[model samples]
Target: MSDFIPVNEPLLDGNEKKYLQECIDTGWISSEGPFVRQFEERFAGRVGRQQGVAVANGSGALDIAVHALRLGPGDEVILPAFTIISCAASVVRAGATPVLVDADPVTWNMSAEQVAARITERTKAIMVVHLYGLPVDVDPILELARKHDLRIIEDAAQMHGQACRGRSCGSFGDISTFSFYPNKHITTGEGGMVVCDDPDLAERCRGLRNLCFQAHKRFVHEELGWNYRMTNLQAALGLAQLERLDWFVARKRAMGRRYTELLGETAGIQTPLPRTGYAENIYWVYGVVLEDSVPFDAEEAMKRLAALGIGTRPFFWPMHQQPVFEKLGLFPAERYPVAERLARRGFYLPSGMALTEPDIEKVAKGVKEVLG
Candidate 1:
């Protein structure tokens, strides 16, 4: 059997080890250190944001962003049903209700039109996720936000370099969050960042990540907060990962193109489309929709691939159907038809940074064999 190709892998070939060694030598391995500050500044600059606050993980970053927005009981934040549960969990954790909406089938992102229709007096924000590294149609979303005076928080965990109209994903939202898990476009082992242009919000994020104390004094705890700080070691790794972000994104794009080329003609499979006016998609994971005419369902295909040492994953389950959310009776299961269908039929192949051309061929061949 061939070596198993993963869905995604981090590329850390730069000064990661050297930076880590420096951190160890300087005894600044904890959350408070120069490396963390430097990493935040560099990442903020890269994302065209004025500030970046490092956190323990992407979920933590979301929690902090929601807190900064002051979204509490009686407030509702609109989000896509077909997204990682963290997007909804963060809102619930922040004491706000998550108003789930359907995703646009082409973009696999929250539908701006759907969001516009769902807004109400209780709606305080809209959380748009750039699912699978494809930038959500932010222009319309931003326009809607402006008209309604609603905050837009981008869940950019899977889209590190994705852009639209020359602006990066993180720059489009009032507060944007990124993940650095190993499977992401970049990795810091396990870390996240929250970026924003508002100085007060940024400062509040910094405080929220560190016990909500006034930064000047150590023993001051002015408000509620959590210890969601990232360590210097993680920042060292992040700096290294950031250095290779462009290279990683380029290789991922190349792989995505190759996949489309190889699979476009395959029967009963629909490749994702890159819309005009969108910036380069980083292809965090290469997703394909299995038409109803396909010989096998997504689960069966995934099982066969796993047996062949080729790992595959299904798309996110719609939040409305989740047991925890179902009990809340907030929305009916059949409301988001697109999201429900995607959850049942969509699956992504391995497009890891480490994947070679032959790996792509093998995956394509395997899928064809299974389907045929």
Candidate 2:
């Protein structure tokens, strides 16, 4: 039997070890260490942002960004229902209401048309979450923001190097966020960042991530905040990884192309859209959605794949379907059919940065066998 192929493993064959060694030798493992600053500057510049505020993790980045924008109490943040719960949770935690929108059938992203329809007098912001490997159609959303005098928060946590219409994903919003989870194109083990062009918004994020520390007086706080600082060790790793982002993206695209070629003719599954007019699919995880004719859903598909030593992961369950949100008395009558179908039928194969050609072949074979 072949070894079990996990869903994701990061590629760290760059200067990761060298930079980490420097940090250990220099005793700069804390969040205040020099590498944190360097990483922030480089990453911000890479994403076309003027400022970057490093945070503990992706969720923390979202929290800081939401608070920095002052979204609270009666403000409505329009977002896609087919996204990670953190998007909705961030708005909810700010005492704001999250107005859900359905996803595009082909792209499986937030529908910009739906966003225009959902806007109201109280709509304060639009949270654009770039899903999987494809950026949400952001130009229309940007137009909507401008027309309504609303703020934009781009969640590029899953879209480090992705672009829409030649513009970098992180540069499309008033404020943007990125995640450095191990499964991402670049990994800091556990880290995230908030990036923006506005100096004031950037400063607000920095203070919010550091417990709202006062510049004039120590241990004095005018407002509440959280300790969501990213450590130097993580920053060191991130800097090294960032150096190889272009290559990593290319490698991922190759892996995705190979998977598509192998599985293109397979029945019962729908592959990711290879490209749209705006951008090509980065194939973040080489996701597959079961067709309605398939006998089982993603859960059963994952079970079968696991038995064959092939790892798989289900797509995000729609926020509208979340019991917690239902309990919160949110979206009582709202229904997003596309999101609901994708959640039930979609799952991703192993498409990690560390995945080799042989691994891709094996995983593709396993998928075919299981689905057959």
Candidate 3:
């Protein structure tokens, strides 16, 4: 038996320990510190954005973006069903209804065509997620947003360095959010950032993270807010992680290419297709779709892999199918067939930063033994 390879793991290198020590030595281990500021600036620059607001986590960033948009009752925000529930929950928290849209099977992202079809007089915005580190087809999505006068909020939680055409993922939307969870392309233990070109939106995010104060003084609450601030400790980790992000992304891509080469010939598996003109794909998880003709479903496949000392994860279980949303009467279970099907059939293999070529080969062999 080999070592049990997990699906994702954080890589820690660079000045993490030194910076953390410095932060503790300076008594600036909380939100107010030089590392936080430096991380924000460097992260914004890396993503080609003018400003970035660090938050407690990716969900926090989404909440801030939703509040900044002022989406209230009766507003409809279009988003794919095939994503983490946080994306839809953010809109719901803002008092807007989330209109579920199907995803492109190849990209596993919100389809612009489906989004356009779902648009109505109540549609106020489009929340596009760059799922599995692959940049969504943003050109058509942006065109639709412009034509329909809908704001675009990009959920770039899984895609750290992905780009469509020459533009980066976070730069295309009215506001974009990213996660630095332990398993993400970069890790800050737990943190997030919201990047926006609009100074007003950025300011609103900053205010919202803290108690929406008038900024001149504390204890003066202008509007209701939550304590979603990111601490200097996390920022220190982020700053260290960001120093090697480019190298990390490159290695991730290389691993993805190798996985594709090894799995492409497997009879009942379909690998994700990288969209044309995308410069980089920081594969957060290497997803593969099992054809219906396969011998086992996603859960059974995962069980087989686990027995072989290889870890795996099933894809998101479509937001519409979740009990919370189903109880809300937002979207019926059968509304998005594609999303449901993929949720049942798709699973990701172990493609962590720490995985060597042999690790991937063992995973491939396990999958082959189970499916073939």
- Highest TM-score against the true fold, candidate: 2
Off-target runs (Cα >4 Å) in candidate 2 are: none
Candidate 1 clash pair list: none
Candidate 3's residue-wise lDDT over 249-334, tens digit each?
88888888888888888999888674456545567789999998986789988998899999999999999899998788877645
In model 1, where do residues sit more than 4 Å from their true spots? Answer: 215-220
Q: Model 1, 253-350: lDDT tens per residue?
A: 89899998899899988787745566566678899889989866889988888777788889999898988877876576457889988998899999
363: Cα error in model 3, Å: 1.0
Give each model a TM-score. Answer: 0.96, 0.99, 0.96
Global local distance difference test of model 2: 0.92
Query: Per-residue alpha-carbon lDDT of model 2 for 1-372, expressed as tens digits?
Result: 558888998888899999999999999999989999999999999999999999999999999999999999999999999999999999999999999999887889986789999999999999999888888888988999999999999999999888899988899878999999999998999999999999999999999999999998869899999999999999999999999999988988988888889999999899989999999998877888999999999999999989988888999999988999999999998899999999999989997898888888988888888877
The candidate, 2 or 3, that scores higher on lDDT is 2
lDDT (C-alpha) at residue 142 in model 1: 93
Estimate every model's Cα lDDT from 0 to 1: 0.88, 0.92, 0.87
